[model samples]
Structure formats: structure tokens, C-alpha cells
Target: MGRSPAADAEFMMRDTTSHPPAYAPAYKTSVLRSPKNALISLQHSLSEVTAPVFRADELGPLDNDLIKNCAKDGLPVGERLLVHGHVRDQLGRPVKNALVEVWQANASGRYRHKKDQYIGALDPNFGGCGRVLTDENGYYFYRTIKPGPYPWRNRVNEWRPAHIHYAISGHGWVQRLITQMYFEGDPLIATCPILRSVPSEEQIRGLIALQDTSAFVQLDSRAYRFDIVLRGQRATLFENHVQGTPQ
Candidate 1:
């Protein structure tokens, strides 16, 4: 359940051949330093980014969409995410058997995390989280609710636009990556730390998508098509799990 800010920002309007790499170094550092990768956070500038890591290819497909989806958000979420990318390592090569995890706030911009304290606004049955793995195609998909802008503690007037966080893991205990996907056209996208991490000059085109009906996606009953591209050795994939908050 997420939305990328590129959907509204003018900067997201321009087109570029893939996102800008000039900002890649910055992102690499950010991703490495995030709580998910604290091991490399202090060494953000280390040369290990080019180090060869292990890979896997034995993951099966996830068939039980009902179990994987946040049923609290409703059933039969549409397949609206359409994505493409390279099947390479973090250095930008192909990664095999990469397990990916996704979680985001629902249409109300509220997550089901323990930190959330919105009284009278909690969906006890709607914990905000989703898990899935990438395929050899370096692709992944999800059907969830539309992400809504939510308030944050970053600033007095700060708000995090609708977005989905992805955590990927594969062979060699390489560790799963914890990143986020943003919906295009979201208004608060400009100040969001997640988006600010990317290059402002880059064309965040492929990141946005208008609601599509022909795709068999219904906001309430259909699925939203969301695809993920992981930079790894060979595009690896994984299955979905029930890691959301306990019912």
C-alpha cells in the first residue's frame, strides 16, 4: 500500500534514461547506513560495495495472495505495479534468490507499527506490511491499498507521502535490503527523506503510474500493480510470508 511522490512533483515529470547515477553514490551511502545495514553504516565509503556476494535460485512462487496481502485493506487487491530493471548485483548485476519484503501505510497514511499511537484510528486487523521475493526476471509484484500521506516526527510540519518499504535477502547471508517505493504524483514527496535521498535531477518517471482499470486492478476489490527492481548479481526472487503485526 504505497504511492510515489513523483506522481505530483514537477521534477518527477521529466524523463531520464533510468534514474541518475550522480546521486547513486549518495544513495549507496544512505542505504548502507540505514538501520538495516548498520554494519556498513560507519564504513559507508568502504570498497565492499564491489565485493562479490553469494546468490540463490531455489525459491518457489507465492500462490496464496490472500495470506500475503493485508486482508484488513480488503480482498483481491489489483495488480497495478508495472516495473523493469537489470538483474545484477548491488554493483548493478544479476542477483539470484533475493528475498524482498515490503510494508507501507494504508490509504490513511498510518502504519501498524508499535510506534503508531493514533487512538480511535487503529485498524487492529490491518497491520501494514507485505513480503515477497524477486524473480530471475529481477522483477516483483504486490496488490495492496493505495498509500496515503502520513505525518512524521522529522519536522513540525513534516509528512511522509504514501510509500512502500522493501527488504531483500538472498544467499550468503548477504542480508536483505530495506528500501522503499514511492508512488508518483504525491504532493508531500518533495520533503520526504526517502525521496530526498535520490538525485533531484534524475527522471523518476517509471516510478509513477495512474490507476488503471484494464489491468484488472480495483482500489477496493482489485490489485494495484507494483513492481520492484533490485540491483544484484542475477535478478533473484523469493516467496511471501506472514510477518505483519500479530492479529
Candidate 2:
């Protein structure tokens, strides 16, 4: 059997101090946003939970290629893009075999979902979902298209930034992370309330992936690099051991 990530990283272990609050008030949709929300005010504790280990044989042929399943007869109509990145733990160690899934709108800001109601034509060739496993070196790469910004019901002329949804599964369910990655120079990023909901400016900045022309492998495709950091179980403990607890 291959090595277990939990042995090296203990990624499934929970650390409340290192992670964002489950309910940040600034994020309107968060259950914790309202003080009267009974769920948020209640005391919570991390449960000792474990998940089944996934083997490589379980993955399908097209799981890593989002464009293949959704595309019609020809290539999808959009700016082709290559999204690649590394998955690391809080201590900066690489986490291999991580399951990474992504989904996004088509070039015209239209999603395949029926309820999107964006008034834009959905690309028949683009269902906009893909998955890939990180390599031994913690590298994961996939081909996709640049999703366009779309308006939401938040405010008048409120448009979301061009972004792709990321769902990463580390060693177990406790390590699973769901977040959005925005384009570095997207104009709507500054005004998007969702991106601003993160309490730490540095954490918010980490969500933006930078365009890298040099990483482009195809003739017509652009490249973007995004690195993800999963919180590790031992990180806070190790820091406390070294620096001592704050007074």
C-alpha cells in the first residue's frame, strides 16, 4: 500500500484557532452572520471522525478533464486556460494525492445549472466541472476556460469576480476545503463582498491566482497558477511549543 498522508501531515485533524470562523458575520449567507441564529451561538466541539481512503483505481478516465465531458463536437467556445498549482500543508510541506475539484461559469458568465438565470447563453460543450489528484510532489494541473464575471442580487449592478470554485479533499472529510479562486487582476474583486468577507487581508489575497503566460502549454491556451494551503493538525501545537502561548 502507498504511504498515508495522515501519517505525515495529520491533515484530517481539526484546529479551530487556525481556521476561519464557521460563521463570519460579514458574509451574508453564513449561518453565523446573524447573532440570533441559534446554531452559531451554541458551543461546538470537533468530533473524532475518519474517512475511507481512496485508491487511484477508483478514479475515472475523464475525471481530470472538465472540457472533454461537457464540450460538444468541437472545442468549447471560450479562452482556453491551463490551471495548475501545488497543494501544501500549513507547515509548507507538500500534500500528495489530494483530490481537487473545480467548477465555474462559461465564457459568457452562464452556468449549466437551471436556476442560474443569468440571461447568457450556456455553452453546450461546457458543463464546467473537473477533478484531478495531486501528484507525489503535490502538483495538480487541469485544462479549463476563463470564467467571466456575472451579476448577482446583492446590490444594484453587483457583479462577482471572475473565479472558479475549488473543492479540495485532503486525507479525510475534516480536511476538505471549499473556496473560490479569483483572477488576480479582476476588476470586480475589489467590490465583491464575498471576497472581502475573509477577516485577514492576507488570506483574502491568497485566493487570487496569477496569470502565467510562460506556463501555457497549448498554442491558444492561457495559464494560471494557484497554490492551496490546507491547515495541518500539528501546526498550532508546534508553534505553541516553540513560541510559548501568548499572555
Candidate 3:
């Protein structure tokens, strides 16, 4: 068996603090204005965006600090979840040691905290958080429960669909990325905030909408499938933006 990542990076790690690369561009106002026409002609969207999938990975042994320090950082410590993604550099070459992080709303679309009353308190057993460091093959995994829909203060009190937020970092943040993974068949998807926030059609290029299944999860529970594309991946195109928004 391979040694743990903690030991693997101990000797090689220099400065662990990092600022990942920015998230992909925002959708064009015209495209985001309407959900019906947004996904039309999304041929090479991922190529234009940085991080594009949402996998429910359980927290690895290393995320204890994130778990104990804050409630906003709650992540399920142990559970099987659906994850998604592909491994390829911008030139189509595979990546090595890609890192992925995820944060999402609880079963009620509310965060785990004392103020979030729209939903109940967090499940003592579940933390709604996780992380995964890809292998040489550029793959990752996480175990988490399904996220619930929540209200967003959009357009006079609008709500976003059930979704999860994510970030990808490696080499202490060489080409890090942040984005969100969406669930399939969500009613609120019709008015997704991240999708609606964009006011540019061209910006709304890489929004994965139920195409590839291999990246999806195969499990017994109602787990969702999701995958992510780091800043550089062969075959896929992108619109490099160094900043990412909360999904």
C-alpha cells in the first residue's frame, strides 16, 4: 500500500499556504437571463472554465483542522458519496497530484450553524464537507450526503438549486481552481444563482449539464455524480479567471 499523503508531502512541502487559480468566467447576462437558452451550444464549456464538477467526498484524515475550527467547514468524516471528473492537462496530457475540496449545504440547503434556522441544526454525525487529493492518474474521491436547496438573496429573494462548492489546488497552489457541482433534476436548477449571476453569454460557457456518466458515481444510496477540470486539461477549452465565486 502507498504511504499517507501527510508523510508523502512532509519532506517535500515548502510553504503550504496557497491561493489557487481563479474560477471560470461568468455566463453572459443574456444567456443567464433565461435558463432555457443557457445550455444551448455548450460544446466546449469546460475548456473555458477552470473547475467544473461536484463530488461528495468524505473528509480525509488531514481535514481535521478544517472540521474543528469552524462550522462553515463542516464535512462528513466517513461516508460514501458520488464524485465526478476527468484527468487531462490543457494539452490533453494527464495531471499528477490534483487536489479537490468541497463544501455544500446540508440536507435542508442550510449550513451547519446556530443562525441557519431555515433548516435544522447540523447532524452531529454529518459535517457537509470533504477533500480529495488525486493520485498520479489524476483522480479523486469523497463521501458525502446529498445537498439540499437553499435561499439566496437574488433578485428580490430568489433561491438557488441544491448545489455544492469546490476548489482544486496542488503543488501548494500552483494552478488552483474553485467552482461548484450541480445536482441533476433539481427543480431550483431552473433558477440557479451562479448561472443567473452571470450577465454575459460568452462567460457562461463551461457549465456541465448532464453529459458524461463515467465521472458519475456508482453506489447504493442516492448519491450524485460529479467531476472537476483543473485549470489545465487537454481537449477541453476554458476562460481563465483567477478569482472564483461561492457556488
Candidate 4:
């Protein structure tokens, strides 16, 4: 027999303690951004929960191929990488047709934004952004150059680890998640203040993507698998919520 609504709801309940506190002082910027008052929960209106449907045709044929989409003169200079993953709900059911967006600095650690005055030279061919929609089995993949680590002003000599930023939206506004995925075996992961802000070692580990040798393309690109659990005890650490979303 299928599960009842109450049982489904129970499976979706978030473990608040599993996530980092919004006021992590070590993270510095979170100080002023954290909530100043007690929070209130509200029920979602039908319009808020169900609008904004994303169609497959709305995406360009090269939308998911960062390596070629922005190429103008030549291919971007960096190690080729294939990042693939599956998105699942709290109950382990696939989240089909979910939209996954990614943006990152170039292999030299410089972003394409004008405000980014990092000394690293930007590759003319690398625009550093891409998007893809998950299949019926919640699988999605993208090709890009492995990003480089860069220094930040958070501390005197602090540097951010090489990582990719992700924004995933499931059916509607309420089913959205924003997180970062770090590569495995990066020594910087142990010391980066932003990653350290996570409450537990296990939760911090969840944000790291494992190298998937099995998926590596011969003489082409290395692959990394970063599955996303959308809710419950194993939810990926999302920047948008302290208490996880029901969706």
C-alpha cells in the first residue's frame, strides 16, 4: 500500500540541528545577515507553490555545455570536468525536470563580473555559467573546466577552495535550494571558514563531491558525482534556509 499523507509529512520533517546556525561568527558576513528576531512560519498560497513551470525547449542546445557555449576564439584553458548528479526528495523519490543552474570562476579563479578585480586573467572563451534540467530519473550533468581557488578578504590570508555554486529549483518557488559543491581531496576544505561554518563534520562532507572514476571519459574529462538530498536529515546545506523547506 502507498504511504499516507501524515507518514509522508513525517518523512519530510527537517532536522534543524543538522544545519548550521545563521549567526556563525566565523563566517563573518553572516553576522549582519542573520535574523534579528524570532521567526514565524507561514503556509504557502497555491499561486506561490505552483507557478513558474520550466519547459525543456526553453533551454538552448548548448546550455548545459559550459565548455562550448561561451567559446569564441578557442576552448577555455583548464582541466576538463564532467559534473553529474541526481536530485531526490526526502523520501528518496526522484525530482524529475528540476532545473539546476551553476556558475563559477574560471580555471584562473577570476569571475567574469566587472566588479571582480582579481589579478587572474579571465579566459576569453570561458563565461563560467551553465544550466540543465534533470531527467525523469533526476539525473543531470554538465561539462566545464575545474575552477581554481582564490583569496578572499574574510581573513588576512584566507583563500576559498575551488568549488561550484548551484541553484536548484524543483516544481516551484518553495522547492528551491542554493548550495556549493567542493571537490574531494582539497586540503583547503579543512580550513575554509565558510565550509567550517557547517555544524558537523558529516554535514560538511555532504557538500563535497566525490570523484567518479567510473564516469570519466577517456582522454577527455574527469567526473565528479554530487547527489543532492532535498530535505530531511540528509538535506544538502542550503543558504536560503535555517529550518529546511517542506517541499
Q: Pick the candidate with the highest TM-score.
A: 4
Tens digits of lDDT, candidate 2, 1-247:
3233332233434455444665655455666454464443332223212345556777778776777766668777888888999999877878788888899999999889988999888888888998888988889999888898888876667888889999988754566789999888888888887766666778778999998988987677888999998865453355446323453
| Predicted structure with the largest lDDT when compared to the true one | 4
In model 2, how large is the Cα lDDT of residue 233? Answer: 48
Clash statistics: count for each candidate? 42, 3, 34, 0
Report model 1's TM-score to 2 decimal places. 0.54
lDDT of 4 by residue, 46-91 (tens): 4334435578999999999999999998999999999999998876
Task: List all candidate RMSDs to the true structure.
Answer: 13.9, 5.7, 13.6, 7.5
Assess each prediction's global lDDT (C-alpha) against the native: 0.46, 0.76, 0.50, 0.84
lDDT of 1 by residue, 49-107 (tens): 23223233333343213234445554422323422232344444445545555566655
Reference-based TM-score of each model:
0.54, 0.80, 0.55, 0.87
Question: 164, model 2: CA deviation in Å?
Answer: 0.5
Model 1 spans with C-alpha error above 4 angstroms: 1-96, 171-175, 203-214, 218-247
Candidate 4 overall Cα lDDT vs. reference? 0.84
Candidate 4 ranges beyond 4 A from true positions: 1-13, 232-247
**Ten-residue segment with the worst summed lDDT in candidate 2?**
40-49
Mind sharing the TM-score for model 4?
0.87
